[model samples]
Structures are given as structure tokens and as C-alpha cells.
Target: MRIAVVGLGAVGARAARQLASTEGVDEVLLRDIDDGRRSEVAASLGAIATPEPQSVTAPPEADAVVLALPAGDHAAAALPLVERGVPVVSTSDSVGDVEALLDLGPLAEAVGTTLVLGAAFSPGLSCLLARHAADLLDDVTEVHVARAGTGGPACAHQHHRALGGSAIDWRNGGWQRRAAGSGRELCWFPDPVGAADCYRAGLPDALLLVNALGPVERVTARLAATRRDRLTARLPMLRRPHPEGVLGAVRAEVRGRVDGRYETVVYGAFDRPGVAAGAVAAVAAVAAVRGDLGVPAGAHGLGASTRARELLGQLAVRGVKSAAFTG
Candidate 1:
């Protein structure tokens, strides 16, 4: 199988590398505006990777394409591909960009192209965890997600902006907008990255969970931040963000009925955000190629369809395991 990865940044480069080594993947087409970066990534992947260095508007033909561009570029890169009936996997974490891509469901369906949205760490794996937890229950009512760590520089900047921006949450059968950095809640993730004070953020997970899970009541997403992080959120970043953090984690708390009784389920996974997101996007692209996911020809969140288990299983093989909270 041939897979195309555009925007060879931190996450995109990792996705391309994984795709190049994946079984049944004969070649990975690498595209980036930067010629040097593209060539470097292609070389790192050896003969299986081909650096296109072409504009995103004219991506090479491949069975599936992974779009790992910046926050605002997902829609533009996905549009032409979807119109051509090409399966797409996006790792965008931006709320607006994700919603814009979700709006392309009709167009993708018309062209018989399956577009997997938010195939990254938080929205991607977080959504998967939500699905897994909800499946253990008879029905689901509430889903609360918390995430810590950043992937690339862009991701860190987005996190900064998210804290300062207004957050959209689903509650009481309607969309509600609230202050982003308000409503503090203590959330505990897996080991090494334990408890943190999480606050609502402009994340795409809430919207995705509501759409993907066929939700009933409330859905909210939050990010872990420090006092300084929250204070500087409204201002421009003073310095470049770290290329990747030491570790990143996502937690999903699902509440609903189990055996007609009230039950709460929590599941989480931890890794470097960039690495995990890359793996998620790569696995999703491979699944799209292998038809293992059985996703429909339309835009969808990673866990929106019935392939959550399959996708999660594939991710586990790559060392991105999900842990359940026993306490």
C-alpha cells in the first residue's frame, strides 16, 4: 500500500516514518513545503519513502493521505484530496479546523472518500478512549476529557491560544460557550504524569465526542496548565516551544448506565504527544488502506465510527496502550 503524508513537521515526519515501516506499505510519499526537511525525512525512511516536495494543492496519488499541516491548513489540504475520492487522515488539534473538516462530510460522501478527522493525540486517542469506556456501559450520558503535554511548536502555541480563547461545550442538549481557563478540576492521568489542575480549553474533543458517540448530555475538554501558562495565554509566545515534550497523556471519563445502574468508566493513554499522534495518524491511514476500519465514505472523528476497537488494537501493537482506572 502507498500512503501520502503532507507537511513533514514533527508529527508528519513521525507518521511518514511509521508508515514506511508498516507491513504491506510498499511506499510512503512525503510532501513538505521545505525541501530540506522533506529530503531529510525521506532519507531517514530509506528507499521506501519518496520525497515529493510538491505543493499540497497537488499531492501525489496514494491509497491514503495523512494531513499533518498546521492548525489552519487542514481544510485546504483535505479539500482537493476528498474531491478526488482519496481517503484522508488528519492530525489537526484545532477546534475550528476540525469543525471545518467535519463540515465536509457531505462532499466526501459524494466523492466516496472517507475523511478521518482529528487523528491525533488528544482528539484522536482521547476520542478512542471515550468510545472504549462508553462501550462498557449500556448507554453514555457524559464524557469529560483532560489532556497534558504538547506535540510540536504549533501544538504548544495552540494550547496557549486555547487557554485564552472561549471554549465550546455541550450541555443540557445545547452548545454553550464559556471562559476557556475557568472551571478548574483536578484530573489524574496515568503514572509519571499524575494529577493536574485541568481547565476547559478550546479543544475539539468535546465536539467530536458529542458527534461521534451519539451523546446524551454533557461533553467537556480541558488542558493541563500552570499559572504562568495561563497568565501568558493571551500574549504572543515569547519563545519557541519545545520540539516535543517528555510525555503526554490523555484521560477520558465516561459516565452512563451499566446494567441499568449508574456507572463511570475511565481510560487513558500516555506518550509523547507527537509520537502518539504520529502513530495514531499512521495506523489510521493504514487502516483506511486495508479497509480494516470499515469507515463510511464521509468525514468522521477517529472514534465516531465502529472501528474504535480495531484502531485501538492497532495502536497497542505500536506501544500506545490505554490504561483503565481501577480506583
Candidate 2:
């Protein structure tokens, strides 16, 4: 398969490399608005690079397009490829509306193409674990997810400054705002990675799973701080714009109750913001090329599809190990 990866930033570059290195992928195309960056990545990977999405999406040359673009840029970048009758897989974490997103289903069908979303680590893995737990139980009463990770300087700055990103939660059949660090802390023991403290925060996949699996009595999301001192230093800047200095860690825990019994599952993937973003993009691209996704069209989050576990398993099989704690 000939794969075109949009957005040659940290995540995009990683996705491009993974795609290029994959045995079944005949060629990989790296595209970005920055020509120099595109050239740099292409040179490094020995893959084709372009600055135009159209150029990459043009005709029979490229078989599929994987969007590693920003969460906000998914619709704009993906529509053109859809118009060209090409399949696309994305890890953008911004599948806003299922109905609207899936509206492209017709267009995709018309052109014999497919678009699958929610192929990233959090949405993919978290949702998968939740679903698996849900399956094990006859009646799922609640689901909780906690994600902790080390952010890059840019992300850390954003967290400390209280700028843009706000921790969110999925509860009572809708998304609700939660103050950062509002959720309770629990000791999570993940295999391979060991035990760590996790707190509740907001996550889109938690909501997605709730929507898919129905109302739960309780569901909370949390964020874990990898370095408290580093995060503390930037606390005063939480209200300002500091995308460049944002860095932190994420760990997600899901708890489900069935038949009056409780079962808890914890999952953790450790990396910086760039690598996390890149991992998401890479998985989305690979799934898109292989035609093994079920993403809706319009704007959506990580939970739009129910393929999170399958994606996570693939990540693990590819040597992307996640820590899981059960107590």
C-alpha cells in the first residue's frame, strides 16, 4: 500500500517512519505545510515528501492517506481526500459529531473509500479495555478512565499557565467540566510499568464508551503528573498561551461493576506530547491503509468508534507496551 501521512511534525514524522518501515506498505508519502520539514523527514526516511495534500491525494499514485494533523485540522485536511475517493484513517482525537462525520459515509461509499477514526493510544486503548471489561460483565454499572503522562515543555507550560487545554469528564450521559486534579487519586499497578498514582480528569473516550455502552452509575477521568515540581513551576502561567512549554503524563483507569461485583482495569502509555501525538497518527494511518476502522465523518473524539482495544493490541504487538494494573 502507498500511504500518505499528513502533518510532518513529531507525531506525523513517527507515523510516516512506521508506515514506511511496515512490510506491506510499498511507499510512504510525508506531507506538511512546511516544505523544509517535509524534506527533512523524507530525507531521513527515504520516503516521498510533499507540501500539498492534493499532491499526495492525487489519483492512483497514493492508495491511502493517514492524517496525523492537529485535532482541529482533521475535517479540513480529510475532506479533500474524501473527494478524491481515497480511504483515510486518522488519530486526530477530534471526531466532534458522529452523524455529521459519518455523513461522509455515503460519499466514501460513492467513491469506494473508507474513513476510520479513533485509532490512537488513549481512545483506542482505553476504549478497548473498557469494552473488554464491559463484555466480561453481564451488567456494567460504571466505567472510569485515568491517563497520566509526561508532557513536553510546551504542554507543561500550557498546564501551568492554565491556557487552553482543560481537563474534561464523561458522566451522566454527557461531558462535564472538571477542575484539574478534581478526581480522586488511586494506586494503579500496571504490568511492566508498575504502580503509580492516578487522579481523575476529563477524557473524550470515556464519554464515547459511555455513549456506546449506556449509562453508568459513575465514570471519572483523571490526569497523573509525572513531575510535580516541573508542573508547579508553571502553575502561574495556566491562564496564558504557552503551547510550546506544555508537558505532562497520562494514565487511564476504567472500573466496571457487574452482578454486584467490581472489576477494575488500568492502562498506561508513557511518552512526551510529540511522541504521543505521533503514536496516535501512526496507528490511525496504518489502520486507514489496512481498511480496518469504523470512524464516523464529521468532527469526532477518540470514542466515535469501538475499535480502541483492537488498536491497542496492535500497538502492543508492534512492541508498544502499555502498563496494566489489576487489584
Candidate 3:
């Protein structure tokens, strides 16, 4: 099967590479506005990758499409594809983008299309981790998510905006809006990533968990940042972000009652944020093509997908493994 990967940025390029090597995927189409970046990534992926220099105004011929586009472009780019019944996997982490993508649930269902939303590190793997933890419980009451590191320059910029923007959380059966970069807490990720100071950010995990995992007592999301990072978040970026960020990690903590006792389960994944996000997008794209997602038709987060466990396993096989906290 052929899969198209739009926007050959760090995440998009990595997704294309993984798709090129994935079994059953015969071809990987790369689309980006940047001719050099597109051709370079396509060439790096070898013969299986074909560069499409033109912009992606319409859905290209492919069994599945992995959209690693910029934050604000995800919804618009996915509209035509969903309308045409093309399975889409979006690596969108932005609050606005994710919400817009979720709003297309009806359209996707009407067209019999599968649109996997928020196929990124935090919202993507983080959502899956949340589901995994919730599965072990009798009933889940709360979920708290945190992450460290950016995926790419775009991701870094998004982090900046998120820290400075309004943050939202689900509390006591209601949505609570608070200032970004507040609610600071010490979150421990997997080995090496260790402990980092995380704070509330404009993350979409709570929104997705509420919609996907049914009602919960509370849901919150946070991002790791330094004092300078929070302070300068409202201003323009001071330095150029690396094309691909340093090692990143995501953590999901689920709290609930099991057998009349309250318990907490934590799951975490460590890797370059871009790599993890790309792997997730690629795996989701392949699953869409193979009908492994098990969603009849519509937009769904990894947390809500019927094949959450299977996909999580697939991700582990791809080296984006998650481990439960023993402590």
C-alpha cells in the first residue's frame, strides 16, 4: 500500500523513513512546500520514497495519509481528505488543531473515513498510555499527563505559545481554565529523562481524555520548562530550536479505585520527541491502511480507539516502548 506523508519536517521526515521501511507499504509519498527539504528527505529514504514538490491542496492517491503539518494547518488539510474517505493520521498537538480535528468526527463518520487525531508524543502516545493505565483499573477517576522536550523547531515554538497561552483542565466534572505555566509540579519520567519541573500548559490531553475515556473526576496536562522558558514564552523565541530536539519523554498517571482501594498507575516513554511522534504517526497510518484501528469510521484519539492495546504493542516493537512505574 502507498502512504503519503505531508510536510517533510523533522517529524514528517522520520515518519516517511519509518513508512518506507514498514512491511506492506510499497511506496511513501513525501509532500512539502520546501523543495530542498522534500527532495532531501525523499532521497534519504531511498527508492521507496517519492517527493511531491507541489503543495497538498487535495488528497493525493494513497491508502493512508500521515499529516505532520504545522499546527494551524492540520484541520484544513484534513477536511478534503476526510470528505473523500481517505484515512488520515494527524500528528497534531496544538489545542486548537486537535479540537478542530475532533470536531470533524461527524464528517468522517458520514464519509466512512478514519481520522486518527493527535498522533504525536503527548497527545498521541500520552493518550495511549492513559488508556493503558485506565485498563488496569476498575474505574478511572483522574488522569495527569506530563512531558519534557520538544520535537522540532515548530514543536519548540508551539511549546512557547502553550506556556504563555491559557491552560485548560477538567476538574470536578467541569472544564477549568488557568494560566499557562502554573501548577508547577515535579514529574519523573523514565530513566535518563529523570525528574523535570512540569507546569500546566495549553495541552490537549485533558480535552481528548474527557471525550475518549468518558467522564472522569479530573484530567490535567503539563509540560517541562525552566523559569526562563516560562518567562520568555510570551515573547518571540530568543534562539533557533534544533531541527530535531534532544531526548524527550512523556508520562501518564492514572488514578482510580480497584477492588475498593484507590490505586495509581504510571506509564512513561522516552525518546526524541520528534522520533516518537513520527513513529506514532507512521504506525497509526499503517494501522489505518490495515484497518487495525477498529474504529468503524470517524475521528478518534488513541485513548478511544478500540485497538489501543494492540497499537501500543506495535509501538513497543518499533522501539517507542513504554514502561509502567514500579515505584
**Per-model TM-score versus the true fold:** 0.97, 0.71, 0.98
- Tell me the tens digit of each residue's lDDT in model 2 across 1-327: 777777765556767877766778777866777777787888888744443543445433477777666555666666778888777766544434223345566777677766655444455455555655565666666766654442333333323432123455555556666555444465453433345565433334554566555566666655454445234543464344332223333455556665677766555555444555555556666665665554544333444445756766666665665565444
Ordered from best to worst TM-score, the candidate numbers read: 3, 1, 2
Candidate 1 local lDDT, 198-222, one digit each (tens): 9988998877788677756999999
Put the candidates in lDDT order, highest first.
3, 1, 2
* lDDT: worst 10-residue window of model 1: 51-60
Clashing pairs in 1: none
lDDT of each: 0.88, 0.56, 0.90
Deviation (Å) of 59 in candidate 3: 1.9
Model 2 RMSD in Å is 5.1
Q: Model 3, residue 176: what's the lDDT? A: 95
Instruction: Tell me how far the alpha carbon of residue 257 in candidate 2 is from the true structure, in angstroms, after superposition.
Output: 4.3
- Model 3, total clashes: 0
Local lDDT at 312 for model 3: 90
Q: Which ranges of candidate 1 are over 4 A from the true structure?
A: 55-57
